[model samples]
Target: MANDFDTIKKNANSFIIEIHKFIRENFQVSIGDQKKYLDSVTKDSVKTGQAKLGSFIISVSDVLLDSMIIIVYTFLFLIYKEHFKLFLAKLIKKENHPALMDILSQIKVSINNYIVSLIIEMIVVAVLTSLGLWIIGIKYFILLGLITGILNLIPYIGITIAGIITVLASLTGSGEISVILGILIVNIIVQFIDNNLLVPLIINSKVEINAFVSIMGIIVGGAAAGISGMFLAIPLLAILKIIFDRIESLEPWGYLMGNHVPRKFAWRVRRTKTQE
Candidate 1:
């Protein structure tokens, strides 16, 4: 019995050592690409100058203002859909991008797997938010659930704006602080699921963007076209990377955008016969 116990201990130690060694090797391999990503971001740091923290604060304020304005316009369009449709038709006609449209369509199909996954995730978010709202005794819980589910289509900003509007609407109707708090709590829970789980799964489907480039894209796009631009920037960058990968002229740009250079060989993981 003592001999058996000693052998077991020795095997466990070997197992642990092998696992650690494998992990260390993988870490060293990934570190090369990590350094390249860092270098790329550092090079772009100069261009991101002047637009700092204060700029983000200002951007937040502008986003809030724009969301509220959108709410107003939404109500207006509800009353006059035909007029809004005419205006939108004129706008799209004036700014046509057939090439861009074709590219985006192809890219969307390429990422269809990720898109379907996102829809499943939004369904989960809807269920949770709806349950929470119902528990909190919100009268329009179903309506709020639908809105929240739709807003989940937009990352980050849309969720917050939708939550705020729902809470404010609740306040206006019920005039109860507890109701507002309940709404806030439910929204927080939904956002927690979104940020921690759904986002990591969906966003990480592609190569991860560096943190600094993401912020810079938000800043630059927001400055150029407000809320729409901020929401569009990340996907636009990803799409650009996809296009660059296809076009030889743009291969360098694709390399610059990506976190990792494509490696031709798959590194094999081997286990000792004793482990097998």
Candidate 2:
């Protein structure tokens, strides 16, 4: 038990160190010249990015949540086999049992297709993240690459929240307090990289919505679809905003839903100073 604990702790420390390096690298991406680069990325690129990011996050979160639900319900299936088995049994009893086989075959094909799509999306994320980590000179670049790519699939605050959760989990399992500190420091640095650099360039450039709208979408989505909704809502809204932006009649609505390219810097500065 002691050895296992020690091993977990060591792994946790390594994980934290890697995470920090990833963050530092992510932040190094150019957010574009405040004056010019914004004009370069098209509205379509923003819409596509938003959709891709949203779909990835929602799908990952859904799978995780579904796994949790399955675990919770597993014991019930065992104890209440008669009640649970009835559904499958009834299907088996159908006159055209061959149809059942066809249905099962279709289900299998669908599952395989879905899994393949997920793998492809994950690959894209990993490549993008790994490139960033490599540039940042983070160790265990592959691991950070996978994590950031997967985590980004979650909408708005999902990636940030996931990083925090991962750091906290690592800290709790770590044997040395230094491991915890290491993880926290690394995450902060990574987030700085993401927020100040990578995200501003990738996410903000694509989704032209303001902070307030994003927050509001998260709240409403969370209420409706729970966490899954929150993750999906932002991208969905961004798509709507994009279409709205193109039409004169709907431009005002889009403006309300979307964000201004350059928010009031002075107001943000004052708000930050006040918080400080």
Please give the TM-score that candidate 2 achieves against the real structure.
Answer: 0.42
TM-score of candidate 1 against the unseen true structure = 0.48
TM-score of each: 0.48, 0.42
Residue 182 local lDDT, model 2? 56
Error of 2 at 120 (Å): 14
lDDT of 2 at 59: 67
Provide the lowest-lDDT 10-residue window in model 2. 29-38
lDDT of 1 by residue, 88-169 (tens): 4565554444544565566665455545655777787888888898898876677778779877765567687678657644
- RMSD vs true structure, all candidates: 20.6, 20.2
Q: List the lowest-lDDT window of 10 residues for candidate 1.
A: 264-273
Local accuracy of candidate 2 as per-residue lDDT tens digits, 1-276: 233556566776676456555555786533334213445565548888899999978866775794465456556756885664457657566664554455445434434443354455456656655665455444455775577657665554555654554444443344344544654455556556655655444554456556678677779987887656765565667656755665578889988875454468878888899999
> Which predicted model would earn the best lDDT?
1
Best by TM-score: 1
